[model samples]
Target: MSSSLPLSGRVGIITGGARGIGYAIAKRLLQDGASVCLWDVDETALSEAKASLSSLGNVATAQVNVTDAASVEAAVQTTLAALGKIDLLVNNAGIAGNNAKLWELTPEEWRRVLDINLNGPFLCCRGVVPQMLKNGFGRIVNIASVAGKEGNPNASHYSASKAGVIGLTKSLGKELATSNILVNCITPAVIETDILKQMTQQHVDYMLSKIPMNRFGQKEEAAAMVAWLCSEDCSFTTGAVFDLSGGRATY
Candidate 1:
């Protein structure tokens, strides 16, 4: 099926494209024939990722902090200027919030999570939508988490932030559905990423045990979905939340 993938001339901007799932998605998009702007906070990783993806296809790098509105706005503009079009926007920049119980979590940590996970998407959407609406075509896929749907005991902040992303996706999706734009979200179970390092063994154990599939999700699988959703193939779905939960989620 992938041999006939249809995104031949799209331009995309993927936040957090420095590494992990974001980089995986970026690579997949390029492989499917898309010009990409890989944005991230880590300058070094962004450079490396850009260099790596350039060998696959056209890829540009931007060092921008998604949590900062000004930085995100400028980055969005730079992407548009450099690419000449913005066919896809993937709001994949986020941090795993504090793992403490809700009552024990600090305000700083909570705000950090909210700012990066929720507000970052908000800023990106706000910045990119006008261009999309102007062009009368756009595809946005936000990377949420299964934790958002079923709250985790120790990850209250992370869970809440993702829930907020889901809410944001729904609201924006509805608002833009009248146009030729599509907005969607994906809820993925534990995929292999450095974020796992932020979790305790007990936390990881609990997550693993709850998975009916009994294993971690692969980055390629999720990346495949992201690439498709960012393509013209996803015309019929809007305001939807897809699950890549390894059988751990049902609804």
Candidate 2:
């Protein structure tokens, strides 16, 4: 891939695009050549991200609740109305609840984690598929986690939710294989982001012990992979899960 690649005419909608990995994806997409629609739940962060990313290229922003069917529908409609087409969808919004034993996790905690990590993608995909079908071209890239694969201790809900995302990606990718759309998921381990601050110290220590590289994965590393999966070069793969866990995982 060219370091200075361009995605000139494509329109992309990135959920949870206001910051972190989402922001990096949005920035990379714009740098490539796509028109970007940034959707996030935080209004202030959305506005700030819009301003910071405006220097890239054609862009827009929407405060959206990815887990809410109505909110997702409205965001998709607004995107199509303004951009006129939806070529890429990055379902990157997610939440990592406090790390605790499975027995200690409450019903509400499990529901909230699943709502954003798994259900959010369901809602966003539901909102975008019809439009994609009409155009016969769409790229969906989901951000999952290494925990989903190995099942991290004290993070039962998060693990299960990301596991569901992987399952969803595989199912959707096959379901849409006959069409122009392609769906795939990426699992990252110990990314250097604000989300890390939310994890317990023990959680961090345990994760680091497993990461053979003994370092956090950069957001740009993940963004590079996501950009490719969203690009024209991603023609032969769907329903696949790629890993960005440094030396921590290989399968």
Candidate 3:
């Protein structure tokens, strides 16, 4: 790898890295000269992702259930074993649970989304931060959503979960401010990804209508922003939310 590449010699862990936005981020990071460890619950997809991405750079995969602390910890160890050290973490594993009004949703449904979308990142950070601190450098870029800010109707669970992610990023960022471990998050309006499949057509259309650009964002666009946030170029910013909302974000 060329020393001039921004992420050269870095090792990163990307949860939900088997596909969609996560896969795009992994590919971008690899192309930027970082080795990557893909963590996902789907073993088959993990294998496929590793096979496809191995040509770009050093790539490894671990079947992980982000919601489980044991699973997250084991994957952290696995990544350390495979890649030596972790310089970046992208908390991207999440789901758009079945759309329903807040009152109509079952407690189980609400908890499931929170467990994966919020608590998962918490565990991964807890597991990975020690290594980053030991190395005295790290970056954490969480994948939040515009819904978290606006709170889309019928997706109360997802919106709340992502909101928690934003809160987590801010608190963690402040906690690591002087440690050289920058933490931040991105709030994307609507990216074209498999997660969309879990939403109703009405909901998708409603989200699309809210964007001033009138077009869905591509996964690569999200990947590009995340790549920068994971690099040394993002040195001065931490605990901030970068908007990828195509002009939909009012704040």
Query: Clash number for every model?
Result: 0, 4, 0
Give the top-scoring candidate (TM-score): 3
Residue pairs clashing in model 3 are none
Q: Residue by residue across 35-137, what tens digits does model 3's lDDT show?
A: 9999999999999999999999999999999989899889999999999999999999999999999999999999999999999999999999999999999
Q: Against the true structure, what is each candidate's TM-score?
A: 0.97, 0.97, 0.99
Top candidate on lDDT is: 3
Candidate 2 local lDDT, 130-156, one digit each (tens): 889999898999999999999999999
Clash list (residue pairs), candidate 2: 6-32, 7-32, 7-33, 8-33
Tens-place lDDT digits, model 1, residues 1-251? 24465777888899999899999999899889888999899999988888777887888877898877789889988887788888899999988865788889999999999999998999888888888888999999999999999988889889999999999999999999889899999999999899899889889899999899899998899999998898887898999999999899876
Instruction: Name the better of 2 and 3 by lDDT.
Output: 3
Q: What are the candidates' C-alpha RMSDs?
A: 1.8, 1.9, 0.5
* Model 1, CA-based lDDT: 0.89
Candidate 3 matches the true fold with a TM-score of: 0.99
TM-score of 1: 0.97
